[model samples]
Target: MIRVRGTVGAWPVDLQIELDDQDWAALARQASAEPATTAAAAARPSGDDPLWSRAQALLREAGELEGPELLAALAALAGSDQAGKRLLVRLRHCDQVEIVQRGEAPLYRWIAQ
Candidate 1:
């Protein structure tokens, strides 16, 4: 189970997602296959869900962003560096995103359909 609460515009947003063991297994399988997960990720609309869904929205909106920039955005949204890093790692493993070396930092690019 995961919980996230924040604001989108002037509206308050709160989200909680609970995945069963079977769902976890399926999600794990989907994660291993880039194409399948990428497609699944896109199907989820970015509403007010502040957990994994919002993390996806951030990367997708940024398109291509530097590590620091992405980190800062996540921190601002998630409220702490540690929380931000957790989301960052989750985003990193998502199929729609690719992290590459830009200079000394990594550039996160959102792969579009």
Candidate 2:
């Protein structure tokens, strides 16, 4: 059994999950059988991911930036648009970041907490 308690936005979250022996075995197998590349890429914790750090640093230094401009910068930093989008999504959900729409465009602003 696993229990998770936290808050999401304005709501509280309480979650409980149970797994039987077979489920545990299957999960262990899947975890151990993960592709080498995927496992290697995630060898470090998410907080230690260089790209994530760089993305946050970029936003911090910029203070505020337009969505498209930030995307282009992140793309350059990440070497691909798709990776940039992934970083953008991370930033969107980050508590320190606030997004404001100005005439159909979102402005990403960093608010240090």
Candidate 3:
């Protein structure tokens, strides 16, 4: 069984799709067949931009969020000289920080200490 959830306006909806073992196995095999290449993997940033690094560390530590949400959050935070306003907004919504914006930009410091 597969369960999916999404929101419409202010309401939330869920859907469940059930499959037999054979069908499940086929789906798993299909997924496993398409592995990301090394260059594609390496295109992701690996660095000390605090927000990107912190977000990555948090994701690793929490082991939650996947697919587009994960990608959007990561892309929002990554590959910038500093974490900007939009990334700050995303991070704040995730409860990752208490942010302060100066004009159109974000100035990030550690959340508490």
Predicted candidate 2 versus true structure: per-residue lDDT over 21-57, tens digit per residue: 9999999899889977898878634777888999999
Best by lDDT: 2
- lDDT rank order: 2, 1, 3
**Model 3 residue pairs with clashes:** none
Please give each candidate's TM-score.
0.54, 0.61, 0.30
Candidate 1 lands at a TM-score of 0.54
Q: Ten consecutive residues with minimal summed lDDT in candidate 2? A: 39-48
Segments in model 2 whose C-alpha atoms lie over 4 Å from true places: 1-45
Ranking by TM-score: 2, 1, 3
In candidate 1 the C-alpha lDDT for residue 99 amounts to 93
| lDDT digits (tens) for residues 1-113 of candidate 3 | 88999988989989899999999899889777766676566765445557756674655554554333544555665654244434545555645454455565444334432
Residue pairs that clash (backbone atoms under 3 angstroms), model 1 = none
Candidate 2's TM-score reads 0.61
lDDT of each: 0.84, 0.92, 0.58
Which 10 successive residues of model 1 have the least lDDT summed? 43-52
Q: Judged by lDDT relative to the true structure, which candidate is superior, 1 or 3? A: 1
Model 1 lDDT per residue over 1-113, tens place? 88999999999999999999999999998788778777878966455655767777888987888988899898888899998898788778778899998788899999965
